[model samples]
Target: MTTQTQPIQAYSLPTPNGQKVHVMLEELGVPWVYHRIDIGKGEQFAPDFLAISPNNKIPAIVDPEGPGGEPISIFESGAILKYLGLKFGQLYPTDPRQQVKVDEWLFWQVGGFGPMLGQNNHFTLYAPEKIPYAIKRYGEETLRLFRVLNTQLEGRDYIAGDYSIADIASIGWAQSWERYGATRAEHPNVIAWIERLNARPAVARGLAFGKAS
Candidate 1:
């Protein structure tokens, strides 16, 4: 296991993507320090933040105790989660087949669920002028993605057959279903899954981080 005298430096806000890393660190019981990169103030574009996160995103990290005991900077929420999981020998399974299952759902969330819902939010809430076509297009897509998740949870307690990073990757976005025009009535399984995750102390703390301060 990786040991560190210094906590991992997390540059992030409390957005859905940022919550993923927060939840993972909390779940793993690892030491980490938060550095808020206020996206609202365009802090992500600053040269220092951009150096690690070339895509100019809020959630990034610098690990002083990385492999070979050398410092390393990492960006992207999914990659960060994978790194932490592997380092701690937790959440992320070692068996090839089990790991593949986790990857499938993890990618599914990052690729389809998060992006489509983000677009829906952009056009529905943030667009200066609401275009009916754009709103309808993204709204429909959001519901479709929610249905996919609901179906996946039919007979399961969590995504990917266990409580892994797949759950961490999705819970942040899934909890905001109402924002994207989804109803719990239509996603009963998803709602139950959300409740199950929220019951965990680490998840509740992670999801609520930065809100009080």
Candidate 2:
């Protein structure tokens, strides 16, 4: 069913992880269509959706123009970013050392930064009962992670050597620092970085996608 001009099909919500793929497609200036998987209504658990994203997560995609000119489905935000970057020859660095730099930060986001922040949000906002230990535990970890990000961004403009997928991966999470009990004053560098990324037209558009609709 995928014709040459059939846009990439994105199945996602507007969560931070979802926004990563959205921002990547926009940044690459690619043609894409969104299929909102309403997590609240348990749409992510649908059998068809699970076939592509077995984890039942948002932000999976099906590229009509895949590596061998066939349809390909991909899950996980980080992997999706890498695949698109490679296909487009943009954002993802080609140089070995520079590429490593981007990979380091990108994995750091997927492994540590995003998960910790998610835990912080769950405990502080979504938890059924307010547990002091969980609140304190995740709260401190969130601050620590923000500190690491701020330090990494002290002198630089982006997370890695250049404005690569590393920055794209973390921008949405960083934008929600306040929701996780962190403040701008605590991480000035991160605040500045957020502003800088948000100022970009593509990023603004990507972040705004799915919000109005």
Candidate 3:
């Protein structure tokens, strides 16, 4: 199967992780279809969705035109972003050094920023028993991570090089700054970067999708 024969299938919702892929696909201008996987409804654990996303997560994708012209399914939002970058030759650098720079921030988000912020969200908003220790721990960590990001963007327009996948990865996570007990006023550089990316038409369109429809 080739992309010409079938559209990319995206299983996701409006969450930050899901928004990452949605924003990427729209930015790449790829032909794709969106299938809302209502995680709140436990649809992520359904057998069919599980076959593609063993972790039972949203933001999985099925590409008809995979490497060697075969269909392939991918999970993990970061991997999906990299796959689309490699496939479309966009938003990622070809040079190994530049690619590494991009990967550094991308992985930073996947490994640190996203998880900590997610924990902060859980403790601050959804946790039935509001554990002050858990909330403070994750909240402080989220702020620390934001400071690191703000420092990284001190003079640059993006986290890594030239608005690549790294920016795409970080934006969704950073969007929850308030919920994570942080403020844009304290992170000027990050706020500037966020505004810059938010102004993009493609990004605006992607962020608008899968929203309570």
| Cα shift from native, residue 147, model 1 (Å) | 0.5
Best by TM-score: 1
Q: How well is each residue in 59-173 modelled by candidate 1, as lDDT tens digits?
A: 9999999888899999999999899889889899999999999999999988988898889989999999999999999999999999999999999999989799999999999
Candidate 3 lDDT over residue span 58-151, tens digit each: 8899998898998999999999999999888899899999999999999999999989889888898899999999988988898999999999
Q: What is the C-alpha local distance difference test score of each model? A: 0.91, 0.90, 0.89
Better candidate number, 1 or 3, judged by lDDT? 1
In the order shown, the candidates' Cα RMSDs to the true structure are 1.2, 2.5, 1.9
- In candidate 3, position 59 carries an lDDT of 87
Clashes of each: 0, 0, 0
lDDT of 3 at 164: 90
Residue runs of model 3 more than 4 Å from their true location after superposition: 1-5
RMSD of 3: 1.9
Off-target runs (Cα >4 Å) in candidate 1 are none
Give the per-residue lDDT of model 2 (tens digit) for 1-213: 222366999998778999999999898887899999988899999999999999999899999889788899999999999988888889998899999999999999999999998988899889999999999999999889999999999999999968999999999898877776667787889989999999999999888899876
Instruction: Please state the error at residue 185 of candidate 3 in Å.
Output: 3.9
- What's model 3's lDDT at 186? 89
